[model samples]
Target: MLTLPSIYVLDICVFVFKNIDKFTRVEDTHNVNTRHKKRLCAPFSRTKTLSGSPYYMAVKIYNKLPNTFKTEKSPTLFQKKIKQYLIEKCFYSVKEYLEFCPK
Candidate 1:
């Protein structure tokens, strides 16, 4: 059975999905392993097939967030929750995260 906390978390999940586009933006960063190249982090390659952006990416990000952080809080909390979750998961502070770029 879903407890009170679980219910609240479900509500937050719904809110995040409802505001998916608002919270998630297309991030332009270096290609998978090529530091010299850059591209949008969407799955679709061609313009015609590209559905503005892919739903999977946003869903993927949301799913990675910890359940403890995903409370039925305000919309602004989404990004903050993600940051907190990441810090806990990776065991790093803001400065350390900024310095540790993937190779």
Candidate 2:
């Protein structure tokens, strides 16, 4: 069952964002800097493997989203845009997706 890692990441991000009350937002915490105010705060993961958990990964990927995408208010539109962007860019790996620099 081959599938795109980016799509999995996208779905995770959307789910997390939709259920934002379950997660900590940077703005809701005092520890995070103001620059990260719009992002979600990832929980501390002591082990490298633990950092790969869906919750952690979702925060990581969501925080990496372009500001334009992050600011989108409509879930449907955001999902559509991200899906199209993912398909067009065709990221080969999670690392590649993380390191992406949109121009």
How high a TM-score does candidate 1 get? 0.32
Q: How does residue 3 of candidate 1 score in lDDT?
A: 41
RMSD of each: 13.3, 3.1
Report clash pairs, candidate 1: none
Question: lDDT (0-100) at residue 39 of candidate 1?
Answer: 21
Tens digits of lDDT, candidate 2, 1-103: 2147877867976887588788888788786567768778889867898798877888888887778877788889888878877887787888888889442
Worst 10 residues of 1 by lDDT: 35-44
Clashing pairs in 2: none
The residue ranges of model 2 lying beyond 4 angstroms of the native Cα positions read 1-3, 31-33, 101-103
Candidate 1 regions exceeding 4 Å error are: 1-53, 87-103
> What's the distance in Å from true for residue 10, model 2?
2.0
